[model samples]
Target: MKQNRLIQNIILLIGCLLLNSCYQNEEYMQTVQQNHLLIDIKDSGIYSNEPISRANTVGYTTTFSEGDKIGLYAVKNGEILPDVNNVCLSYTEGKWVANSSISYSEDKVGAIYYAYYPYDQALSTFNKTSTDPFEALVSSWEIGNDLTGDIYTGKDLMTGFANAKLEGRNYTLDLTLGHRMSLAVIKLPTTTYNFTNAGMSSYNVSPQNISFTIGKDSESEAPILPYYDITSDTYRILIHPNTAYTLKGKFTNGANANKSYTINIGTDIDKAQYAQYIVDQPEIINYTLNIGDYYCADGSLVSKDGPAPSNCIGVVYQVGTTDAIKNDYPSCNHGLVYALKRVEGDPIKWSTSKPSSTNWYEKYGMLLYNATGVDIQGYEETKTWMDIETGEVEGVDINSIMKSTLNDYRQNFILPSTTTDWYLPSYKELDALNNNATILNTQFSKVNGEALWTSATKDISYWSTTIRRQDAVVQYHPDNKTKAGYIRDSSGYYRYSFGF
Candidate 1:
């Protein structure tokens, strides 16, 4: 029984040794899988062979050798394999690196974990028992050009490449160089002065002193430079950054008078400012008068000869035997002092009588008259008269007879005055007079049906001294006479005289 126990102990000793060897191998594989140099290909099925396993070693890893065609398989779940159907291969540092052609499948855990590393053709395959083929390949390969420039570098098989510089580094790039600038210039309308009638065709005006301020808005805090030119009495300004500017000009005239004008130099100038520059000039003020006509409120017209001291054109009238310059008269008599007619319309009657006063006749005391007939009650009174036997007298104070006869004449004609200034009207004055023939015939009476003579005459004949058509020849009379017209029968026959 002791001999049987010794044999059993030897068998136990062999089993313990084999168990220790397996445990050591497993631990070494796990350590290789966790190496930093290995690109994690566990989730990348980039080859059509088995994953990195103890069973397949040649397809999972490769080493670079001249003219070698090694197929690289991606790792998936800590195993290198050639089972990746959708896989692609690329060269890095003269070695074939592998990656999955398709994006990581969302259903797989850690599907983004894929990797490859520099490899060589000589070491054509990984050991069958090795767990990390990517780490092993990296350790055996030499680095080459990473393809990305100085800004980036390759870090690991799975971590691919990264920007090698620090964050927030500053850089500048010129998009375009040696470019030409384009500009637009808008000219404002100009003002001109002209004097056509005054014999001035053109006049010279001086250029105005002006200034401009540029800004973004009317108010902005940017430093801007301005450039300008003045040519042909116009101002041209250019401001940097193509912004808005305010412009002002000061102008002075020959008379030393000064004025200021403001404008805007921008895309949109104020409309009112532009309009003010286009204003219209004012008109001149001067004129003349015509001759031979009197300037009146209504207009000009032909004038007439009038009186002196107050040289105004007085109205004209005719004189009759019965007309008088005094206001008092016979109770039944309504005589005229002078007969007048208006140049406009029908004749208007006027008198110098004082209302409600008996001293009216005394106011016209300078008036005188004569008569050669019978004695009348007011005879010596020199203001009344009576018919007496006729006698030829050169001059007589037959004032009473004349006054009474004059009173009768005044009452029947159009008269303007009763003062002694009343005289027989002139020819031109009478001709211009306005008269109504219908009224005149009805107002006057003729004794013995005889027309009496007036103070107005032509040559030896007693002719009416009224003007006609601005001429002196035409006269009115009852008897058509060559040189003498019958006034009354000399005591029995008709007689004529040159005096009224």
Candidate 2:
């Protein structure tokens, strides 16, 4: 009876074990069929010009650059899962792996998820993790708010949401990261000039740096450091998505000056990008003079239209479009005549002496530049200010000969005016003055000034800087507007005109 009892107990125990194993198998099968959550993540956008890594530095990317990270939030049963709140889903190995596991209970209707790139630490403690799909339409982003993180180091804020799609027993949530922010690429116009050659430290005429304001700018301050791409010569600035902004930066001349400008980036910057080419030109032509204005002794123009100032040296009579008067005035487009009033004593001759080394001035009649033809207009007009400045009569420029005491032009320093700044006016420039002689003479009278040409009939003529090699020196007196020149050795008064 004892043996039979032992055998029965062993069989009962074996049956219990077999039953338990069968139950475990049933449980495993049930677990396999249970609904679980899964996600397939991707980025959706165009390729960017500023590449930070595998993804664009400006954050407009359509593919994941390995090692990219994003915050994942899951919602089930109309409530955001506590464990999935701003949970970091880092791209690892070959897949996105979550630090903490999250699964939807079978009782929940469907799983919803919101994911965004460039996870921020501040978002973890935020209490409001609402499950609304439109939660993105309005932002509570202070600097890098919500789970959006507003901006990455040099990237746009990418956010996207999707409803879970069911695949048999698994709920797969697909999140495609996208963003709406202005990607500003500021570039200065390519200039051929080397600014450093002209005493400048750094001559790239570009904005120092760019900063942006979200909303009204009065609401909050969000300044971003721009990424400069030297290869492309571009500066990239990322603005907060969907917010009104004003991008600001001071345009500068190397390290010299600051030029301020305000550009409104209202809703227009939504998901768009632009390349602003700053129109900057280094100064080579400075225009400050106009006809009928007081030309200062120092070659500066008086602001007003009429009357001469106490420092007046000459009156402006002509402007550009005339090469006859063009000279070494590096900062001006116009020039002034020297000593508005002529000779301290009385009118003098063109010269009392000539160079002793040679009688070339006597034989050529002092007009060496127009040696070949004096009758033909083009041939006779071959002379320019450069010829007199460069041509030397016995190793002496014509200007030095004129500045000599033997000539009528004074060498003494005229108060408020430097006689050195003066140059004898050419025939074309003298003609230009002749055209406006009446007005100039009128101004001279008003300023207690004396002018060379008082009128057309004033037999009182002034010496000119022009000379024909075959003829005598030219005179300021003109017989007609069309004549090439008039050469007369008759003693004449003298005045000098200066190029600004």
Q: What is the TM-score of each candidate against the true structure?
A: 0.15, 0.37
What's model 2's lDDT at 90? 72
TM-score of 2: 0.37
Give per-residue CA lDDT, model 1, range 1-500, as digits (tens): 88998999988999999999999988886554332122212212112122333243212122223332223333445454434422344545554344543222223223222323322334444432445443454443322212122211121122121111112221111111110111112223322223232322222233222233334346543322222223422222222222354545453331123455445544432210111121123222221111111111111111222111121122112221232322232221211111222122221121111123223223323121112231111112222212221231122221232233334544443222212322333222222222422222222111111212333422122222221111111232333322221112101111111001
Per-residue lDDT of candidate 2, residues 1-500 (tens digit): 99999999999999999999999998886566455567678666533433343254433344555666788766776667677788888778767877777666654455567787667646643323464453453254333421123234325556778887777656677888766454556554331212222321221223333343323455654444565655666665655544566655554332223455555655444453432434355422222445666655433345335445665667766543233323332333333443476555555443323333434554433344345533211111323332443235444344333345323343463423212245556555667777776677777766777764545436655556555332345655655332322232345555665544
lDDT of each: 0.27, 0.51
For model 2, the run of ten residues with the poorest summed lDDT: 195-204
Number of backbone clashes in candidate 1: 47
* Candidate 1 wrongly placed segments (more than 4 Å): 1-200, 218-232, 253-257, 264-500
